[model samples]
Target chain A: MIRQTLRMARWEVIKLRRRWMPWVFLAFIVLSSQLRLLTEYQMYSNADPGRIAVQAGPANEEGEHSTISISCLDIRDGLVESRLSGIPTEFRQAALQEVESLRDRCPALLGMYDFARTNFLNNATLPGSLSYGINMFGTLGYLFVMILAAMAIGVEYTWGTARQVLAKGCGRGRFLAAKVLGLLAVVGIGHLAVILFMGISSLIITYTMAGTGISTDVMQWLRPGADVVKSMYMMLPYIILGTFFAVLTSSASSGIVISVVFYISESILRWIIGSYLGPDAARILISVNTPLWMASLEFPALNNLSEIYNYLRDFLSTFLPILAYIVVFWGGSFWLFKRRDLKPSTGV
Target chain B: MMASNDLVIKTESLTKRYGDILAVNDLSLEVPRGHVFGLLGPNGSGKTTTMGMLLGLVRPSAGRFSLFGGRKPHREALTRTGAIVEFPSFYPHLTGRDNLAFFQEISGNGDSVELDTLLEKVGLDGRGKDRFQTYSLGMKQRLGLAYVLLGDPDLLILDEPTNGMDPDGMAEVRELIRSLGDGERTVLLSSHLLHEVEQVCDSVAILSHGRLVVQGRVDELVRSLAGETILLRTTDNAKAIEILSKLNWVTDLNSKGESILVSAPTLRSSELSEVLSRSAVYVAEMTLGHVSLEEYYFKITDDANGDTA
Candidate 1:
């Protein structure tokens, strides 16, 4: 059975190799990185240092108007006047306080921006924009990867290739299992490409626009790397869900449609539940639970889990629900695929 | 001629029920080793359904079957068997050679240079690299035949193997199937093309409405029908018919033009010759014509349906 599964998995790899999916995936990531660089460059070149500079304004002292310089966060503090000026003043203090708590964060953003516009100005470091790029992947990359997963399984049925493979004595479960592994293998390689492409692009853009002043802080570099890991953990369930819907509907379009609908509906459902029942109660939903799990890792204050009696409670709350989602979608797809007959769909 | 132990496929009371409809009912069949066995039936006669069951695609509603002497269907039983059920299914985006390579890998039988050779065998030598969707229907059918020939499986189950083929392509597949039956492989093919089956199969089973109507060696079925018709041309046909009608085994005697048409259970031209010669009616010509499988197939199916009606 293992041998059969491995063989099926290898076939899946060949399928991706022979098709346009992997190339398309790579092209998409590169294009997205380029777009990010372009947007960052535009924002960097347009930045007016005067915005965050102390401005003399009419001050009311004893009901008399007098010129006084407003005190504000300074560029000398190694902060970008552009990104900071956009923050609403009412929340400016809070945001600054948060940034101050992570002292090494601002220089990286500022240096990344300056290096994006000037090649010799600053040296961009590793994991600079990869942290942000992976976050984007979770949304945009999620959709593309889901589409890939859907096609991986959907083509087998639509083309009647499932019958051909199954007729070779491959168990249904084994075939589906191989497809899932194949999808992961493709996604894994795609993720590595995204990281390398996005990471290097971020460095080049940062180094070109800024100067050779990027932080050598190992801890900050490690944070984005951790984010990549977390995003990967989150991606597995989506791939499995995509495969499940693909096999169930027997069409890649339907699988993509259903996955998007389910994802959006889960978010909507979480909102409705949270509005009526309370935020904690909304955590019962996977859409709420998964993001909240990531939040607990990124921002402990979001869920107040830091005050929980057991330190492991927050981890369990997040891990179990996502694990359950993986089990239901992945395991359920295997079961259905195995139990059903190898019937071909109406189209190729 | 192969022994029971040499049977490649054996089914006892194998049946399939789709809710209230019996798609295949009480099908008991034995395909001996080294013979090209044909599953003959008309549309909706359960030929494809039986093939589906044998290939483990359809779950039998009742009864059981064995592949390669095993009493139950299992993966190991299918490792040495290849099939094309219904139509030839392939990935439209992949080339024919890639499609075969894909299955070859999944079969865990390792790679062989036969991939291209099999394509050539099916008249797809130069076209192996073409995408499957670009091919005509006949080309697709040939590719499907080539796919089954992979790994040199012991038993080949093909359903309507020549359904979409042109005459040349059909003849090519017929020859390929015949060549595979060279005292080593067993092919269980199903088709509505009776003449094709007659030309290729050593033994055949005719099915109608999920029931086995008749099954035996093609020659035996034809020879069995041969004894029923005897044509005699004599000088005194009227007297000869009268005398032949008196025989215990003779029936359905009638006169047409100057000749007599008769149905007899035991037809021997020698006996009739002796009887006619002794009666002083010299016989000029006497022949026993055999029924073609086409005629025998329809006769039995029409009779069965007539009885049902």
Candidate 2:
């Protein structure tokens, strides 16, 4: 049984290698990472290193904003001028507080702005990319693997190849399991490809634009291993969910639609639930806990049983729901695949 | 010639139902080892459904089946069997060689399969490198045949294996199937094509409306159920019927449209002409031929329908 499943997995990889979908995603990620870098480079070059900048635009429109930079030397004068002008009365009090705050830490915003941009640019590099690339990966890996998982299962049904393989004594459950295994293997390879390509491109583009190799003093530099593992761990539910949709509908397009919709809608629901209903209400969802989990990857030394217990509690609280999602989707996939009759292509 | 009590495939009251509709009903069958067994049926006769249940592609609503003596669908039992249910399904983007290689690998026969050899055996060697999508339907069917022949499985279950093939391709497949049933292998072939099954199968089970209508050796069924019919035009139709009716060999005698239809063992048809001549029911025109599976199926269907007129 083990031998049959592994062989199925190997064949899955062979088929995946010949296909265009996963490679297309790899190219998309690698190229888009650079485009993001070039855009960031433009913004970095436009602002002086020690300038305080406010990004202002209509609230409804995002990515259509202009930065109003205030040099460190003119910080007080700019606040005073804005206050004395016919700004709203509410702005006068805010300006007064801001001016006082700046008096004590006038260069703080300048350093923060520079660090934020440079840290992001440094993501294209190795140790930096690991920490930073995981974030990039985290933001997009679900979509990447969601598509991968869907195609891996969905194509088998659509092409009528599932029956072809199953007829050869490969168990239905085993075949589906092998497909999931193969999808995960492809994702691992894709992650590496992203890292390698992102590193090389960022090095070239960052040096050419900013006159130095992408570098960062960011704390994430020390956590490459944790980042990669967590990024993959975090994507499990989405990957399984994608499989659920495909197996349930027996179509790749349906898997992609429902999974993508679930992703987008859940993010929106997280904000809505967090705001109107409260954090406790949002806590049950994957969207809320993923960031919480990502943010709390570090633990203070387990100096005592109390601290260790607390850490474990917090970890389980976040991890258990993800486990539940994996189980449910995984169960759903197997239930549908095993119980229902294998039919010919229902199309995309 | 390879007939035996050792069955390669046996189904005991095996049945399948989809909601209210029965797809395969109480289909108890035995395909003895080392014989090419044909499952003959019309469209929607549950042939594919039966094969699906055997292959574990479809679950049986009731009853059970065994492959190579195991009542359950164990890995070893399934591994010993290879099947094609319905049409040949393959990944369209993959070349023929890759598709076969993938299935062969999963079946645990990866290490030894010479894909090129299988392709050549199926007359698809040169085209094996092309994507499945590029192949014509006949080529695709040929590839499907190659897929099942992998690993030299002990039992081969093929459902309409020659579907969508041209005359040459069909003949090639029929010839291939005939050669494959060479005593060492058990083949359960399903087809609606009567002559094809009659030509290739050593024995057969005929099914209708999800029920086994009849089952026997092809020659035996044709000899008994598919009784020979001779169409004759005589100088005196009344006298011809009177003469043929006296002979025990003449199972049926009818007259219509200027011809006397005589049903009997057509091999003894020479006696028919001789007997008619002596009676002066002189044969003006005569033809003798044995009934094929094609006729027996229709007759059984007619008998089952029962006095529709």
lDDT per residue (tens digit) for residues B207-275 in model 2: 877888788788887778534778788888898898889998787776757887787876787788899
True contacts kept of each: 0.70, 0.89
Q: What is the alpha-carbon lDDT for the whole of candidate 1?
A: 0.76
Screening candidate 2 with a backbone cut-off below 3 angstroms (N, C-alpha, C), the clashing residue pairs are none
lDDT of 2 at A94: 55
Q: Give the per-residue lDDT of model 2 (tens digit) for A1-348.
A: 788778777777778888898888878776776676666657756655344444333333564644344454466446445523554455445544554555566567567666756655565454665455556656666777787888788877887888878888788888888988787777777667766766676566656654456445555555766766776777777778889989988888787888788889888998899999999899878777776667644575767887778888888888888888889889989998989999855542
**Candidate number 2, chain A TM-score:** 0.74
lDDT (Cα, tens digit) per residue for candidate 1, span A1-348? 788788778778878877887688768876776576567656656643322222222336666432212112244455444545655565556545544444444455556545544532221235456665555565556667777888788877777778878888877878888887887777767667767777676566556644434557887678776876677777778788889899889777788788778778877888899999999898767667656555524434446755553556777878888889889988889877876666644576
